[model samples]
Target: MLDPILKRIASSPVLIYILRCCIGFLIGYKLYITYPDFELFWTLLSIILVISPEEKDTRRLSIERFKSNFIGSAVAMVMLLFLEPNVYTIIAGIFVTIIVCRLFNVLNMARVALVALLIIMVQPHQTGFVEAPIYRFGSVAVGCIIGLLIVVLTSIIFRPLKRKFGIPY
Candidate 1:
């Protein structure tokens, strides 16, 4: 009985998403309450786990994520130096960033571009171009690392996942 229930829970994507969201929200809320400055980092990490591809696909996603972020942030910094940023400017930058990322043929590069655009436009003073890009990149790196660690730790401790799934160790 417990085995069938566990299998069903593992197999259901919707259930998994719901669970992840709940957990993410709780963790995000706690982080926000404890350290508001770091809330976004934790929240974004949670979201990353929800959107992350399978373990086998993580390598490609991680590579694309890193490359796109670095390039997009650089482009955003150059743009910021040239133009005065406003809502319209930020939106336009996002469009341009997306186009460029798509040209590069990197998966989810648009998301990285959006992140870069937001960092430049929304929090320029708090984190200048010189430092913001590094901070943004660091946030992503930390989040992905934590997410991967969680996956591995859960798999090891629970030991419920079947070997037949062909997931990389």
Candidate 2:
């Protein structure tokens, strides 16, 4: 039935990547428009970052980015509690995030963490001082969670079809 279609689609790496990107963009754009207040570009970017041509890579990247985003968000929230959101503060946050990522063995994905840090620490103060960081952190978390869910769900749906169709895992 649908297994043949799914297998055919999964057999081509380029097709898989294109399908992932298309789905990611649709989800990201929907979130962006639905939540007009949050800095959802971060969410969109995170979704894009989590998607890979291979299911295994997608899962791994989602987990890594989720952890990196959490580290960055926590550092930003703590730093904002004490210091003002100045250029120097952002620079300091970046330094701290990089060090933390290296310590956690996520230096390879430090760029994603730094982006999360910047999103939280360098806002335009549209929201209340305390609420801004919280909102940004939530948005980042939503992106990571949604991206991971997509990977998990897709694997669940496609794995059996792939196996039955004699496609390589």
Candidate 3:
């Protein structure tokens, strides 16, 4: 009976998704403990973006995510260092992120980039408005790494299961 249940989980995508989610949540929990002030919002967002119930190209998503984070962080940092924090700067970040995505033909990254821009713009002043972009950039970069790691781990665990189920590896 236990073997039958294990085979069902191995045969399905649900188990992989669940495992991936656990990894993300564990990161979030660890961060929260280490830094009491750590807002879990971005971590949760990362989990949602990284783990999918459906099959996806994790590599493509990871690349887009990293690029988008870099673009948003760089734009936000430049704008804050040279100019005053204002709505216009946020708008400019959005436009720039969109343009870059178009240039790279990775339009799907626009949304994630835009979110990064918003995060930078609205960051708490106590932490110094200047630090927002840097923090946001790091957060998303970690997310991308976690996403890739999940993909690799899932593939490794599932390959043997595929054989056990008499499915092509």
Compare the candidates by TM-score and give the number of the best one. 2
Candidate 2, poorest ten consecutive residues by summed lDDT: 49-58
How does candidate 1 fare on TM-score?
0.54
lDDT string, candidate 2, 38-144, tens digits:
77877787777666565557667767877888788878988898898898999999999999999998888898888888878875756889887877777777777
Top-down TM-score ranking: 2, 3, 1
The order by descending lDDT is 2, 3, 1
Off by over 4 Å in 1: 38-78, 81-83, 87-92, 107-112, 119-169
Clashes of each: 0, 0, 0
Q: How much is 119 displaced in model 2, in angstroms?
A: 1.9
* Model 1: residue 154 alpha-carbon error in angstroms: 6.0
**Please, what are the lDDT tens digits per residue for candidate 3 over residues 29-146?**
6775776554445655654465545545544565566566556656666677777877887787778778887887767777766776676666664355666555655665566566
Model 3: residues with Cα > 4 Å off, grouped in runs: 37-44, 166-169
> How far does residue 144 in candidate 3 sit from its true spot (Å)?
2.6
**What's model 3's lDDT at 59?**
49
Among these predictions, the greatest lDDT belongs to 2
Evaluation by lDDT, superior candidate among 1 and 3: 3
Error of 1 at 155 (Å): 7.2
